[model samples]
Target: MFKIGWLRIANGLIYLYILAPLAVVIISSFHPGEYLIFPPQGFSWRWYEHVLMSGRYTEPFWNSVKIAVVTTCFSLPIGTLAAYALTRYDFRFKNAVQSLFLSPLVIPTLLFGIGLLIMFSALGVKMYFTRLVLAHIVLTIPYVVRTMLASFSQINRSIEEASVVLGASPARTFWLVTLPQVKSALAASAFISLVMSFDELVVALFLTGPGLNTLPIMIYSDIQFNLSPSIAAISSLVIVATLAIGALLIIFMQQRTRKSTDIEDPKP
Candidate 1:
């Protein structure tokens, strides 16, 4: 009983640590004053209005959406291929190839961004929206690959063999048999890639110049020049948006899991 009490206390503390900052930010965002203050003097939606009215904030928000969408689109196919190769096939240098594909996750983001900027400059590639999209895709691929690989690992290989024995081509077998098994993982991976690309700041900061600021970059610049409740308002908005996406993904994956279980075990 004493050990259980200590464990509960520790868990409660950890939860508090995680939620304290978010609670503070959400409260600060409602401050009636122009600048941020804890235990706000008054409460109002004026800051939210300011965030909505600001072109600087809205433009970058849109840019973040475009970049995240493009990043997911590009990353999904490449990551899925890499995951399939890693999980399903035997090949020379397989470990090396997997490590190389996942290297971005291990490397420091700032260093990676600097190297990319230098390399792109040398290649005469300008830092623009398309380039930013490509960079985000590179950064987000590892998450998709890792998640999909986990999903693929859990699948039974004999299903593929059974399909082939039934006269299905390898491609047909994969499309008809393997894909349904791993669909939940793909959905989860895509959501993760989308979130990672959307919330990314370091690479975006280095790559984005004038006319290409993402929402995070805009928030960074705004904080640098001024400290306002509106910044908190923007942060709150982003936090809510991201949480909504995450919750939807979780709900989707749960439904998929239930459906997969039902397919696996039918009742008479």
Candidate 2:
């Protein structure tokens, strides 16, 4: 009981450490002051209005949404296929291949970004949006692959094998049997990949072309030149949006899990 109490306290403290800055940012956004400060002088929505009304912020935000959406579309299919292959198939250098795909998680993002830039230049691909999406896809795939692999690990392979042994084609088994089993995982991976894509900044810094930018890039530029409550307002909005989406995903995954289990369980 004592150890459990201590653990709870430690966990609470860690959450405070993580959430304190977010709380400050939320509070600062509502401050009436032109400059950001902690414990805010007073409450107002001027900064929120500024961010919502300004084309400067909205354009880059939409740019991020476009890049993230396209990146998710490209990354998820490739990542899911790669993960399935690695997890289910035996091959030469399989461990090495998995390592290569997951190496980005250990590698420095700046190094990865620079490497992509050089590789793209070597290939003579110069389009801005094309380059950014490619970089994002590279960055996002490893995450999708990892999440899907973990989720796949939880499922029983025997079920899939039974489907195959029952005369179902591999494609049919995957679509009807395997896909349903991994649906929640796919949703979770999609959420993670989308978040990583939207929150990406390091790769964007290198791959972004003239007149091409993202929300993070805009925030970076703003921090470098000027700091204001407007940025805080944007940050708070992003936080709220992320929390809302995350909550929805959690609820969806939970409901999906319950439904799946209910379907599998025999009636009493």
Candidate 3:
């Protein structure tokens, strides 16, 4: 009984620690005052109205979405292929190569940002969108690779072989047999990559050019120069978007699972 009581207390504390900031942010976003404050003065949607009507936050938010979408597209294929190579092929320096690809995850992000800036400068690459997309892809690929590696590991090799033996081409076998098994993992990786790329600011800071500011950059700038509650409104919108994405992914995966299970167990 004592142990159970202590465990509940610890769990409650953990919940508080995790949710306290979010609760504060949600509550403060509705503050009627010009400045951000916890235990908000009063409820109002003026800040949200400003965000929707003014192009300031909306532009940067759209920029973030565009970059994150492109990054996710590139990261999915590259990371999945790298993961497949590591899992399905036996070659020299495999472990080394994997480590090299995953090195960014271990290295300091600030250092990576600096290195990318220097590399771009040395290469005379001054294009803003190009640099931003490339940097975001680099940052996001590791997430996909990590998820793919785990996804591929759990796949049944015999099922793949059987597909190939039963007149399916290698590409067909992968698409029809191997791919569906890991669809959930791919979705999860895409989510992670999208979220990370969307929120990424450190590398973006070094690479962003004129008119290329992302949402986080905008928020950071706003916080530095002003104490407007508009920041809170924008942040709340982001939180809502994230929650909506999470809900959609969960629903998608559940439906996929149900279909897969239905296919396996036919009823008359």
Candidate 1 contains a number of clashing pairs equal to 0
RMSD of candidates 1 onward, in order: 1.9, 2.3, 2.2
lDDT for 152 in candidate 2 is: 78
Query: Distance from true position, residue 258, model 1, in Å?
Result: 1.8
Q: What does the lDDT come to for candidate 2?
A: 0.90
lDDT of each: 0.88, 0.90, 0.89
Error of 2 at 175 (Å): 1.4
Candidate 2 runs further than 4 Å off: 1-14, 122-124, 263-268
Residue-by-residue lDDT tens digits, candidate 3, 1-268: 5789889999999999999987778778899987777888889998899889988887888899999999999999899989988999999999999998888899888999899999998999888777988988888888889999998998779999999899999889888998889999899999999999999989999999886889999999888997688888888899988999999999999998888779878783
Per-model TM values vs. the true structure: 0.93, 0.90, 0.93
Superposition error at 232 for model 3 (Å): 0.6
Candidate 2 residue lDDT tens string, 36-72: 7887898899999989987779989999999999999
Model 2 residue-pair collision total: 0
